[model samples]
Target: MNSGILPAAVAGFSTGLSLIVAIGAQNAFVLRQGARRHAVLAVVGICAASDAVLIALGVAGLGAVVTAWPAALTVVGLAGGAFLTCYGVLAARRALRPAAAAGLTTQGTSAGSVRTAVLTCLALTWLNPHVYLDTVLLLGSVAADRGSLRWAFGLGAMLASLTWFTGLGYGARLLGGVLARPAAWRVLDSLVAATMLAMGIMLLARTF
Candidate 1:
């Protein structure tokens, strides 16, 4: 019995990690907050906890209900796409201004405020349609057939979320020195802008 459960748990861990390791809005926000060393704990906690809740719901069979209501994901996709496009534009604007990027890296700004950080983290997590597809529909669908070991699969997935968020939020500082430079900041922001823009376009395009 334990042997059968172990494979499912491992599969859950790998799947959960794979789904989240991509460069997405939530990750970009978390990395920025982590690099800024501002409200890192709050950002990481929110991300991990949100993932855990989503995974649990998925494992508990919420995925079927969500899949039944495609309209819900459409709404989320529309909102999330708009938000990502706006954020991408802001990032692009910042990248164009070397001084602004440099200042943001050094002096910081109101965007780093705890309230703003937490709110942004929440929005990034909850508003994204992909999160629903991956966490609820995909993971839930897979876990539903795990028989008695379904919860074990969920527990493993939840652990993966916690580990990934903790590492990302805390480990971001390793690149602090590189991002401190204006040129490097430009590169980072440019990548972030492109990523956000592409993702937003993809989401919006899919809806049409």
Candidate 2:
């Protein structure tokens, strides 16, 4: 609300949304989970909270630690790539089966258990190297330039994360009826498969 911090916060919000709007492994997973109406709140919470924590760390200058230890990101990339590949395969298989795909969207319990969903969300959030690059290095640097308003910038960025995820997770329900059809599921799953596979391959390539 302070006039001094307003511009920094606006800049932070714009930058944060620009980075987070990209199509990536985490976004794809969130879309699918949202469409399925599976642990939507938990999934959204984990994503937003994770982003907040990472952004806070960045504002606190932890990006230096990350820069010093690049190997940690490599390890995460390998694990994330493997998980994505596996998820892609499952999506592909689901797409091939009309019956399985048809039932997935309509049933509240069709998706994995809440704990499993939460774990998957966490993995997607933490394991992706790009998250660190974007949130820690890029956003951190931007926030640093804000000087006295760094926390304000970080808060604005964090607000963007929360707003985006809440909209995405809840907005997806609008497609519930449409996704209930087998053809719709097939299309969605196929897209998911392709997105996951491409992202996984890219991550793996970076690791090697």
Candidate 3:
């Protein structure tokens, strides 16, 4: 094992972790699902898998292809923005209609099925142009700079993503008690709504 590989992997992990730890739409969904103990494993698995593919693609030089076809991201941005906005609207409705939320939350689970969660997770991940811009373009470009160690960096980044999503999805359960309360649920959903709507709007606005 070349000593340089270790440092490159560590750097990759730090960079990947930093990129994803934010309270974006994807993380919010993961948090909400985890806190509720609803299909958490599936959600985390999807997120980690999606990121691995993207990061791998980036390292494999798909970044060049993406750069050549910038319009592709525009298409994705529009779809992602609309989906986020609609989901945000639904979250806001749940927050506003506590009575309705109570019925949904009383069962200690959201109305979403595993399929729905999976689809939403996919949409949140794949449709968002930022994922490509950051992971594919930025991370890929950075990894390329490593020359022979680009794959090592990509592996480190992939590991970081897996560890982070797994930790985030499982760790949020620590707050399950607080989030179980109606008041807390309202607050969480409200934040989710705000985050989703704002990100959605930004994506849409930027696309134009």
Candidate 4:
């Protein structure tokens, strides 16, 4: 609310948006599911909610714990990188598979079955040290400096996550038909593989 806090809130929102707007595994999954029109809204909702909780925790001073545990952060980075690499390999394999005209179908309309999406989103959000650095440490530090307006900064960051995820999920669903193409799948797989490998290499490089 205060004029002094406006800049911090805007900066936090921009930071959060930048980190999440990328074509990461989580976003790819959400997009694929959205394209399939299978529980797209629910998936987005889960992701947004999870991010809000994490960001809130960060703004509430949980960043201090993370700041004190550099070793833990390293472990999380390694694990997250490994997980992403594995996921990338799987996606590449799927893409390389023979194209079936039938494509993916929403055989089961179980929008309420939020277990898989929720768990995946949670890991993508909380298990990655980069997330802690971006949202918890960096954003939290800036928000903390706002004194009483820390809550406003946190809200802005939280809204950024919600907006990005919702747009990604819905936007991807709108393109499910085109992306279902065999050639499109191949291209997507290649991109995913490259992205994952690059991210892993970067993480490993940082350890040195």
What TM-score goes with each of the models? 0.93, 0.95, 0.95, 0.81
| Candidate 3 global lDDT | 0.89
lDDT of 1 by residue, 73-128 (tens): 99999988888888899989988999888886555445557788898788888888
- The predictions' CA RMSDs to the true structure, in order, are 1.8, 1.6, 1.8, 3.0
- Model 3 residue runs over 4 Å out of place are 104-112
Residues 1-208, candidate 2, lDDT per residue (tens digit)?
A: 6797888888888888898987777887888899998899999999999999999999998889888988998999999999888988998999999999877755655345777889989988998888999999889999999998999999999999999989888898899888868999899889889988898888999899
Candidate 1 regions exceeding 4 Å error are: 1-3, 108-112
Candidate 3 lDDT tens digits, 100-187: 6655444544456777888888888898898998999899999999999998999999999999999989998899667766788888
Decoy 3 TM-score against native: 0.95
lDDT of 2 at 159: 91
What's the count of clashing pairs in each model shown? Answer: 0, 0, 0, 2
Candidate numbers sorted by lDDT from highest down: 3, 2, 1, 4
Residue 101 lDDT in candidate 3 = 60
Clashing pairs in 2: none
TM-score of structure candidate 2: 0.95
